[model samples]
Target: MSSIYIHIPFCKQACHYCDFHFSTSMGKKDAMIQALIRELELRKDEFRDEVVDCIYFGGGTPSVLETEEITLLIQTVYTHYQVTTDPEITLEANPDDLSEAKIEALHASPINRLSIGVQSFFEEDLKLMNRAHNATEALQCIMLSRKRFQNISIDLIYGIPEMSTARWIQNIEQALALDVPHISAYALTVEPKTALEKFIKKGIIPPVEDEVAQAHHAILVERLEAEGYHNYEFSNFGKPGAFSQNNTAYWEGKSYIGIGPGAHSYDGKRRAWNVSNNPRYIKAISQDMLPQDVEELTLTDQYNEYVMTRLRTQKGVSLSEVQTLFGDKMHRYLLQQAQSHIEAHFLFQEADRLYVTKKGKFLSDGIAADLFMLNLFQHPFDQNSNQS
Candidate 1:
């Protein structure tokens, strides 16, 4: 199924570890929204042959906008595309923005899912991450959101510098106790030029230990699985029937249109992305231009993309499907690349499917890269746009 992703690039505050495409100031908010609407109009034909099944309002922080602004954006999508009757519309929000009035407004609005960025449930961790919301608001918003929104997902981070295993367990237990349907947990990595990286460089923050993160991941997988949450994706856990349709469709390589500054879109053969600079993006869109770079994927490029995305999921890579879509040469190349990992017990092929073992889940990215045909093509985009 096809989808639409609108990136709202304004945030209340920048988290210490985040290097996403977002502006801390909202001075260009109005212009950006108009640009987003115009982008949707311009890219309408990309999905004309397919009806939209999901619309994701991801950000800087989508909840930073007023409810009316959110409605206007969704209305623009409906005006430009053939949306399903019950589209899975998700708004990426921060706890501080979801006041009682705001939640009530969203209940009346068309948004069906709320992906709150509640990175941690402890006050110290919140401060360490520079998250705008306090620990109380983290719990409070989820409690309040449950009253109106059932399809809710909370984003959490583990392996903070000195964060204890008990605290990590507390974070997971808190999320489970809230009965949130989906949980997207990630390890804390000190990205280059980010505050976390600088702090670590200056001995202000301790470096992230791989062992700590692995242990945390192990606890997360085991505990969440016992709690009936499926480890559907490497970083995501969801209850049965509560998986994210928008993300699942994306992971499976479906066509999607991405609007707003810094958003990326894929249309089967090629990928395109908007400019990261807010002012530049607004100026170009105002002149009726799509301020983005587009790349045409070669056969090898497509095969590598398939391997990276497919390997991260529970399904792994299907050898038969690979042969059908990518040809015998590519299929043989993949098998050749995977043999070493299978020998290491990091990967196993059962029947026609290749799956990552529990021992290899935390190292999935490196493992996927190990299987990549890097000599085929250059990496796409500036590496800064890694977050979804």
Candidate 2:
């Protein structure tokens, strides 16, 4: 099955820690929406014959779109793709944008899921993050949203230096108390060039200490588990049957089409990403061209992609599927390299499936890089090629 991702690159305000490609300007919203519909038609044949399982409206913030704009995009997808009867159409929204009227529009739309960007429930944390919404609205919208959308997933950012273990526990407790179907929690990382990094450099904000982040991460695991949330993916926790279908499809290497600036698309063997600049994207697509960079995956590239994504999830890497897709020699390499992690109690093997254990989850990125193919350095994803 295939999936679709639409990037709405407009927001009311920019969060300090966010490095995503989005603009604070709404002047281009009308043009962007119209261009998006045209681009969807342009890339209609990308997915070919696979049935579309999920359509994700991600952002700057999708909730910023008017109801008519949202409806028109949904119509565009249905017109061009082989969408399933009950596709999981999810919209990424901020608490401040979810008004009563917008909620009513969402309730009546084809969109069936809501993924709210409730980074924190505390006013202090929200202010530190420079979030547009205050703590009151964050809590208020969830209560209001539940009446309309059944499949709701909210994001929580943990390990902010200002967020204590007790405060983190309260955040988890509040989410559980709300009883949303799914939750995705992440440890904050300071990416280069973000305001958070500059603030730390200037001593305006304290840098995130690795040890402190690790401690908070431990608390997250313990508390979410206690609250009956399964750590499905490394950063995601959900009750049974509530895992995000869109992201799960990505982790499983399903082909998907991404429409909009900074969006990426993968069709098993090749991947492409649009130009990140809004004006450049609009100009290019206005000329009937999809402004994207493309790469065809080499065998080694494919293997590394699998290692990076699969190891982060609870399912681990499936040896049977590996052999089926990559042939015997690749399978042999995996079995050989896996013995070390298994002996170290980081990864466990069961009936040909290799999965990361609880202790191994934190160091997953390092482990996956270590297992990369030694040969075939020409591939864009070759870890060693990019590393010193």
Candidate 3:
């Protein structure tokens, strides 16, 4: 039930909208890799001797690392952690870094799943995003990866202002055409302090249109459904049994260990994150200290976390389970708060489970906020739910 995530903080180029803690320079790659391995060994017992079921390599571009470095990291993890016999080991890669040799090396490693960053399969889209790979590489890498890894997932972005509706459909079709089993699609957002934001502020790049993003989301759902993919999470689709176990563990409140700079870990009751700077993290680990911060979750914080996460998945929230976990008093309060959303058709209650309708899925975050047990200690009962 425990998972592990290792962040590889190096990228070939910076995406205009990326605010993730990654460096375009490869200067510190070697030191960072060694530091990650050291950190893994130092914190081997963080998971309470539970069998590790999932290990995910996420970040700047795990694909950019030399295959031997990755192999060493994997070997170090296995040497310390009690990994399961059939662990779901995933590596996040990018097309530009994927070569036949690289894929072969990955196949030889412990990695069983590949999550490639293929933001778009169109050349213009790639340029606008400032991605390192071109359209051809994006399309070809998936095909090549299928020969090496069967449990494959790719990342795709939608809602770019210049991207046409037809093009978005083409992206979905292309993904289907590649026979990819899983996909993580997301709507483009201009985060503050990112190049995309600066471009918009400087009037260099057009602002993202909400209407366009919503339309693309609708198209994505319809097309993927027709293609027989389950819309498991709001932005994730999988072909039966192919959901990312590592990510699912996160949503289900399972404990996990995270290594490397800017990585996060949650131990059911508390959450922690390492320092985001590579140099800082390396220096701390060298001194045998984990450069991280931790926070213990309060009861209200736990309830709100459950509501936010469960509402994002297709299964929704289970009233009985909520009652069992948070007690009957909290359960009744949740039902009272969810009443208006259920009445408004934004949320539906069936057989003790609550789910967001397709019409309301786009507004899920807003709805979740509205349904939050914010004033849990205040009301304790008889709360009025508003249909926002």
Candidate 4:
């Protein structure tokens, strides 16, 4: 199934760890919304033959928009494209934005899922990350959201410097107490040029240790699984029937259209991304021109991506599908690359699938890299956008 991702490039304040494109000023908010709608209209034909199963509002902070503005965007999609009878529409919101009134209004809208950015339920963690919401706001918002929405996901960050193991467990317990159906937890990595990196460099904040992150991940897996939450993807856990359709589609390599500035889109064979600059994106859309760069994936590129994404999921990589899609030569090459990992008990082959063991989950990305068939036809644009 196809999906649509709309990036709202405005936030109340910048999170220290964030490197994603966004602006703190809302001076051009209305203009950005219109530009997003116009981009959707311009790209509707790309999904003319495909039914849209998901419409995700990702940020900066999508919750910053009023319910009416959000409805208008969704209505635009319905007017221009084929949407399913019941699509999984998600809004990535911050706790401070999800006031009681806001939650009620959002519940009335077409948004069926709420992915709240409740990074931590501790005051210190919030302060360290410069999150817009405090611990109380985080707890209160989720409690309020549960009254209106059943399908909800909360983001939590682990591996914060000076976070003790007991404190991390308390964070998990706090989430479990909220009863949200999905949780997407990630380790805090200091991206270059971000305030997080700067703080660590200045010795103002302690360095984030990988060993600590790994330990936290182990606790996360053990605690969530004991509570019956499926670790569907490496960083995402969901109750049965509560998996994120939007993210699952992405992991399965389904085609999707990404609207707004800094958004990325992919068809089966080609990927495209709009300009990250808000002014430039608006100017181009206003002029009825698509301000985007496109990349045509080579066979090796496709295989590498497939391996990277599939290996992170519970479904693992299908060895037979690998051979079927690539060839006997590439398939044999993959087996050869994976042999060492399998020998180390980090990976195992059961029937036609190769799965990462619990011991190897934390190292999945590196393992996938080792198995990558380096592309000789590397596109220059790919150097910047190849992470996914």
**Which candidate achieves the best lDDT against the true structure?**
4
User: What is candidate 3's lDDT per residue for 1-388, written digit by digit as tens?
Assistant: 8988999999888999999999888988888988999999889878656889998999989988888888899888889989889999999999988888889889988889999999999999999999999999988888899998999999999999699999999998999899999999999999999999999999999999988998999899988988889998898999998999987888777889999999998887888999999889999998999999999877677778888888999999999888777776778778888899888898999998999998889888988888777754575532222110
Question: Which runs in model 1 stand beyond 4 Å of their true positions?
Answer: 376-388
Per-residue accuracy of model 1 over 1-388 as CA lDDT, tens digit each: 9999999999988899999899989888898889888988988888888899999999889999999999999999999899889999999999999999999999999999999999999999999899999999999999999999999999999999999999999999999899999999999998889998888999988899999999999999999999999999999999998999998988899998889888999977999999999999999999999999999986666877898888889988999888878666667777888899999999999999999999988888898898787754343322221221
On a 0 to 1 TM-score scale, where does candidate 4 land against the true structure? 0.97
Candidate 3 achieves a global lDDT of 0.88
Model 2, 150-249: lDDT tens per residue? 8999999988967888898899889989999798888888988999899989999988877777777778888888878888788888888888999899
Q: In model 3, where is the ten-residue run with the lowest total lDDT? A: 379-388
Top candidate, metric TM-score: 4
The lDDT of model 2 is 0.88
What TM-score does structure 3 among the candidates reach?
Answer: 0.96
User: What TM-score quantifies how close candidate 1 is to the native fold?
Assistant: 0.96
lDDT of 4: 0.94
lDDT of each: 0.90, 0.88, 0.88, 0.94
What are the models' TM-scores? Answer: 0.96, 0.95, 0.96, 0.97
- 361 Cα displacement, candidate 2 (Å): 1.0
Evaluated at residue 241, the lDDT of candidate 2 is 83
Off by over 4 Å in 2: 377-388
**C-alpha lDDT of candidate 1 relative to the true structure:** 0.90
Q: What are the per-residue Cα lDDT tens digits for candidate 4 across 71-147?
A: 99999999999999999999999999999999999999999999999999999999999999999999999999999
After superposing candidate 3 on the true structure, give the runs of residues whose Cα lies further than 4 Å from its correct spot.
375-388
